[model samples]
Target: MKNLILLLVTLLFIAGCTSNKTEFKISNNGVEAQVLQLKNHQISYTVKKDGHVIIDTSLIGIVVNEKSLGSNSKIRLSERFSEEFDYSMFGGKNTAYHKTNISKFEIKEKDGFTWFLEFLVSAEGVAYRYIVPGTGTQDVKGELSSFRFPNNTKVWYFERNNDWKLKSHAGEWLCSDISQMPAISKMGPVQGLTLTCEMPAGGYALVAEAALYNYSGMRLEAIGDNTFKANFAEGEKGFEIEGDILTPWRCILLADDLNSLVNNTLVPSLNPKPDGRLFADMSWIKPGKAAWYWWSGKFSTFEAEKRTVDNAEKLGFEYTMVDEGWERWSNKWETITELCNYAKNKNVGIFLWKHSNQLNFPENGYALMAGFLDSLKQTGAVGVKVDFMNGETKSLIDFDEALLKLAAERKLMVNFHGCQQSSGEYRTYPNEVSREGIRGVELNNMKEGPLSASHNAALPFTRYVTGHADYTPLAFTAPGETTWAHQLATLVCYYSPFQCIAENPEYLLKTQKIQPAINFINEVPSVWDETFVLPQSKIGELAILARRKGNDWYLGVLSAGEKKQLQVNCNFLKEGNYSAEIFSDDILAEPVPLEGLNPRANLTKRNTAIPFKKEVIICDKNNNLMLNIAANGGAVIWFKAREK
Candidate 1:
């Protein structure tokens, strides 16, 4: 009887051990994540950094046909492969990009079907996606994709608006202790949020959707317990999985510091590589500045618009963007063609704008979108800015994809305005040179008044981490609430390959007081080979960056705080002599009245926006220089390699 009882106990122990099955792991750049098979045969994962658990086991599954397809899933087969690749960029934070390992687990459901869960371990972070096989069309009811944070984890996110048409993607970023993350909105579902976490154990992680093609844009809904579930927009829960589909990647961008976070390549790396063959001469898809007319809010005629193009020539700007209302001009088509020809003579390109709704088919009888793109190309205009596409439903994503392919064939560059947050799809379509996803300079003129000083300082650590934005950095805002030096620094702070500056020629070119910084602005390029975030930088307080272009390094320092002396270290430079040109505020120089300024700016009471002092200093890589920056002001320092 005793032997029989012992045997029964041993048998029960064996069964329990089997239920706690082994897990698979993939690691890169000091970050590791474990995929666990739970007792219920469902899939779950835990993330670790430096062998410390940052994210405890979290659920990972999908609901299909109104049922939980993964509830009874068993890992039937597992495979792992690692590879590395490199490519050059036409325009990006990095001139060259590298991507590196992927693991695949085949989960067999109770229905005798197998689907895949794929993970790509990257240097900056980890990304995972679902691949549903044998699919004619699978009614994907919902997903169990969720992120569970460790105790005391913090996150910075924009409280997303339910009405996406109101430029929902653009908003001032806010931070919260995940434990106390607010439940916002009338429905109180915590909808439209994307969590970018500041891990408790150090380092950072931004939860974002990547390579989103043919999939509905996602938002994270707070479900309590310091967790957020991946969910679709309202009425977009039914995800149609047509054919063998690779669902968009749910990515976590990890970094150890502000510099690493700003330099994370997780987003674009998940996207398919660009097909260089799209254009006969890819050089035409270059990176440079543009003269934009609409920001002035002045009644611009054909002659005024043409003068903007002429300013492009004078300023060495590669393009001149003509915003809305251009179509209302008499003989619109022919008149635009004439303007295009005029710009082409001066070696400047023209970019025309059109409301995204007008570009759609059927009702507009535009019949063929290709015809419109072709006409623009014939007129010698180099690009088009598609605006007001404020939503990201499946059909709209398809429209964006189709439009990019069409524009590529016609050799016309494209900029998506008032759009959704970038999923790094630009890697697949380089023609998409710029996009507006952040609450940029336009907000600086809203009835609410200029974007807060903190908002500008904090952007690099938040929004710009995913991709560059068409902030249209305004040099014209000096003398108002922000210093001219601060406005000038944005050229380095915000990057848009098709960099459109929100100012007419006079303010930028002929303004006497602004000339000191204008010359350097003209010389600055819109792309960078390397970037370094200085130690003094703080979120919503100060921003100091050193970005390299060829042999020169541009240092931009923006302060949202009071006047104080700050030091700069040229540690990023090589061990050799260098020339540093410093441009900072001249506080005593009189203020000017606001013109060409939107009423939202409300600078009824303003200061001298253009007064600046320029000084040159000789330095080496080891030198530390002090700068006296004013409240709501900034400075720019250019380091040229004298040794080289």
Candidate 2:
């Protein structure tokens, strides 16, 4: 009888423990997150695709003023909501992208400090944020958000190249298996905006952030065995959080295939809709190619810029950037107006540049910027490229947003340079088309700063995972560092709404040797309706991208290490006849190879331009074509579907 009583007691104890924990399931499009909310205890979660776990039990919480948020907290309330984004980002990838997601959880913690730990799960991935409500102010001492992967997970990431360490969120793409993973403290800070993980559970995930506002930028730091914790920028001190605080949405972009990973719109979907009342006339914003003199080793002058506008018109480009040196022109504003007028006749828009610091003075910053922007708009300029804002403190973020709003007020587009990673800012403010958080092509001006073929190959998978980077691609100033064909391929592979081409006027418009490449550049569209990362692509080795604008499909294949044959198939096309225009490295006109002695240098210096060849062919849905690419070379194929 005594034994039976004891057994009943034991069973009740087990029941009590189970009842204390509640599992709230939020799922969509095969991606699901099960958040286990412990009553008055620490909270944790597990993310899964179908039934397989992509993220093991991971902790998610934030501490305010040294008080634990998730731990020793009560779930005072919970609710559900749905959101839909039907409008388009005027200057982004898709013309009109539709999104729907379900929201779960809004917990209340100590002293009416009602903070809702909300999660939005969409088909692309999961995004969550902490919405803390209060009256006065709050100090966020720490963020305990972390992603704990399986012991054998492989992470494809990059080291922080700038002084921001990982804060800059820009560098050469890299990958690491178990042996190369650095220790927690020694790893400094790694990329947080977008970091890819080859899950041990048979899928892929990209860790990133979205909708950043009034907060310091985030960088991930190795915290444990195959785990990374969210670390805020170190210099972001005393950032006052007043009223209701909405933290940035931490995003997990998931996919079963490389194509899905590359095309997921979770990052942008998390951002709030653009202010309809502010930007009622979205037609003013346009996305197209541009010609710039920066990478041409030439400075812009009044007459010189007119010549560039002519080059832009000749190449069928929609815009030309006067760049930094135009201010040095005597009677700068008048010269700018004259250049803008000249370009206006040829239907080419003009872009101007400004030092970010000049717009930061508290005394007359707003007045100066407003006056200048108004005057510049009067001069027929279309946009401004604000440069040298290399930090991510909350103050800097505030200024950046202010600039975008100011620029937008005058119907001007803004491109930020020396900036932090694009945390889906373009989604909210589409007028800010692109940013140079990336180490772009202009670095070739340095004797030792030329980019390698492998680095360019890795770009689409790594750096571009965030958003449009103003890489200013297809520069021929440092020829033979990569084949001109390779440079041409970048114009297609890279994503920039501004699509700024930095090739000099002479070679791009006059030289017949590279006319095929130039023609290919002029034909491809800047944005696409569809993008497919071909199965042949291997990160850091090769990039095979198939993109479609209207009914025409363009396939760009870039080879990194050595001379090799890359094939293209018509499977990506619909069932119909298509005429394909192929531009490739000229087999009969390869660069003259010289005996190389320097072991450190990757490519031998060449003084002459590398030649290319173009071919026209008819293909069907089942056709396959194989073409040889020289070392550090590439090819482009534009397939136009025939009329029925």
Candidate 3:
């Protein structure tokens, strides 16, 4: 009788412990996630795709004012609701995400704060954020969000803004055991803000942040074995905000293949919609190629400025950017107005450059910018490129947003250089065109070798996935271990709304040798309506991309320093015949061994040009195109749909 009583007591104890914890299941399509609301304000979640666990119950919470929300703290759910909606984007992959599910819960903390927890699951990935209510202003101490994956996961980590160690974004995408992962450091060897994980359980996951406004950018620091914690910029003590605070959305892009990572719209979807009035008449905002004087060793002289404008007209470019030296005149308006009139006469717009510090004065800062821009608008200046904002502090982030709005009000376009990567800002402010966050072609002056064909191959999947990267491609001075065809393909491979032509105008436009390649660059569009990934594209090896603008299709293939052959079937075309124009590496052209050498030696004067040759093929029901790319070479095909 005593043994039976003890057995009943043990069974009752197991039931009590289980009842304290509650599990919530949310799913969309093939991806499903389960979140557990545990005792003491602690929470955990596990994400699965097609019944295979991708994220294994990772801890998620925040730390505020020295109080730990992920640890021992009493809390209770006040309300729960689920919402579904679809919204349009001004500039993104598509019109909408089709369907989105938002699950929200209001939890009241016993210690005087109420937190609104939200989990948003979509076809692309899962996102979540925390909103603390009832506040005039508050300082967030830190965040307690973490990702604890299963053992033996592989990751493609790009060290963020570590120009000190990793020059020109050149480093290994180290694939190693998750347990051996090192913590991310701000000023040490190399650390990353973006973590792309190849899960051990049959799928892929990308850990990144979205909707970064009025908050410091987030980077992952490995805290333990197979675990990473959220770390913000170190100069500030968390974010300072007014009224109720809605933090940036932390997203996990889960997918089965590389193509999804390129096409996922989660980051832009998290951002607020564009101000309808700002975009109601977007005809003023034009995205096109421009000529720049910086890379050509030209300064603020009439001859240099006129040279760039002449080249802009020669190459059929839409704008010419006068870099920093234009500000040398004490009466800046005189030189700027004269140059603007010169560019206007040549039918090319003007883009000016400014230092961030020169525009930071409290009294005359914004007012001076307004007056300066107002004067330039009369001379037909279209945009301005602001540079040297080196950190992601709250003040800087807010300043960036303010500048975009101010530029928009003045009917001027904006591009941020030396700034953080695009966090869907273009969606909110359509006037904001491009940013130079990635290590771009300009780094060739400082580093060598790694910034070659392999680096170009990795960008479309890693950096371009974030947003518009102002790489300022198409350099004719030094091709850098790549053929002219490979450089031509970069015009199509790298997507920038505001692309700058970093070539010498005298060499690229005046020379007759490369006019065939230059002719194609003159016609390529800066933005696309649709994009497709081709097969056998491996990072650091090769990149094949297909993009659509209007009714035409453009295919670009970039190859590293290895002879390769690929047979491409035109089956992706509509059920009709098409005409294909192929620009590939000339097998018969002299193989110039230019790798690891000073790039300036190969330049030609205005009279001498190196000509290139390509083939034209007609694709029908019975044709499969064969591409033979040489070492450090590339190919591009322009296909036009034809009637049968």
**lDDT (Cα atoms) of all candidates against the true structure:** 0.75, 0.73, 0.70
Candidate 2 overall Cα lDDT vs. reference? 0.73
Candidate 1, residue 86: CA error in Å? 1.3
Worst-scoring 10-residue span by lDDT in model 3? 602-611
Q: Tens digit of lDDT per residue, candidate 1, span 1-644?
A: 43234223323322342344758888887779888787767677778888766666667777666656556778743788886766666433565455558898898888787888998787777888988765588676557787778878877766434454224477766677887764644334444434568888887888888898987777776666667776665343476767776788988878888888887777877888877677546767888899987776544579989989888888888898889988889988899999999998999999989888877773343447778898888888999999987777666777788788889988889999878878888878888889887777765555544666777888788777777788788646523467777887888877878999986665577767667767687888898888899988877788898898988899998788677688888888877888999988776666554664443354654533535689999998889988878787888999888955
Worst 10-residue lDDT window for candidate 2 reads: 593-602
Error of 1 at 631 (Å): 1.6
Clashes of each: 5, 0, 1
Query: How would you order the candidates by TM-score, starting with the best?
Result: 1, 2, 3
C-alpha root-mean-square deviation, each candidate: 6.5, 6.9, 7.1
Backbone steric clashes in candidate 3, count? 1
Clashing pairs in 1: 478-609, 479-608, 479-609, 591-607, 591-608
Candidate 2 lDDT tens digits, 435-528: 8877667655545456778878887877787688888887554644567677778877888888888667656777656665566678788877
Among these predictions, the greatest TM-score belongs to 1
